[model samples]
Target: MKRYGSIIGVKPEKLEEYKKLHVAVWPEVLAKIKECNIRNYSIYYKDGMLYSYYEYIGDNYEKDMQKMAADPTTQEWWKLTDPCQQPVENRAPGEWWAAMEEVFHMD
Candidate 1:
């Protein structure tokens, strides 16, 4: 499995709303995540940033991501959650969250 990490800035004013939304994530979105071979998914909040970590078990990461993105349920989910986030200044083109390099891992 390949691990991924990313960061995005959360608006301070919307922090509670973001947290509340996550407390009961939509079933369809959760299913799509697993359907796309994403596991151990977690999102953490610190300061003004949201950090996401997940493991990709599928052979084709890009294709799985595309599938997730193309899902109507995920699209509707993003409509609610996207507004509470701000893309980091240095994120790659088309990235809503700035991907991070994993310099070291021991496990």
Candidate 2:
């Protein structure tokens, strides 16, 4: 499995709503994430930024991501959640959340 981490800023006004929405994520959207081979997914909020991590268990990362993107439930979830995020200015082109490098890991 491959682990991925990403970071994005959150609008101060929307932080509470964002947290509330996450309190009970839609079941269909959660299922879609698992269907696409994502596991151990987590999102953390700190200092006005949101950090996310997940393990990709699929052999084809790109293909799995494409599948997730195509899921109606996932698309709908993004529509609700995306607006709460403020992507970093320097995020690479085509990236909504700036991907992070894992410099160290153990266990």
Candidate 3:
């Protein structure tokens, strides 16, 4: 499996709503993520920073991500979650969640 991590910012005022939404994620969106070979997914928050981690078990990573992005359910899910997120100042252009570099791992 390939591991991935990303970072985004959540406004302090909207943190509660964001946590609530994640507590009961939409089933269809979850299915779509699983269909794309995503597993062991988790999200963490500290202060106002949100970090997401997941493992991709499939061979074709690009295709799987494209499939997830093309799903209507995911688009709808993003509509709700996106508003709760604030891109960090250092994030690259057009990036909502900045991709994080993996520095170390033990297996």
RMSD of each: 0.7, 0.7, 1.1
Per-model TM values vs. the true structure: 0.97, 0.97, 0.93
Cα lDDT, model 2, residue 99: 99
For candidate 3, list the clashing residue pairs, or say none. Answer: none
List model 3 lDDT by residue over 1-107, tens digit each.
99999999998888999999999999999999999999999999998999999999999998998899899989999998889999988988877799999999988
| Winner on lDDT (2 vs 3) | 2
Per-residue lDDT of 4-105 in model 2, one digit per residue for the tens? 999999999999999999999999999989988999999999999999999999899899889989988889999999999999999999999999999988
Number of backbone clashes in candidate 2: 0
Q: CA lDDT of 55 in candidate 2?
A: 93
Q: 35-88 in candidate 1: lDDT tens per residue? A: 999999999999999999999999999999999999999999999999999899
| Runs of candidate 1 exceeding 4 Å displacement | none
The clash count for each model shown is 0, 0, 0
Task: Give the alpha-carbon lDDT of every model.
Answer: 0.96, 0.94, 0.93
Model 2 lDDT, residue 22, Cα: 99
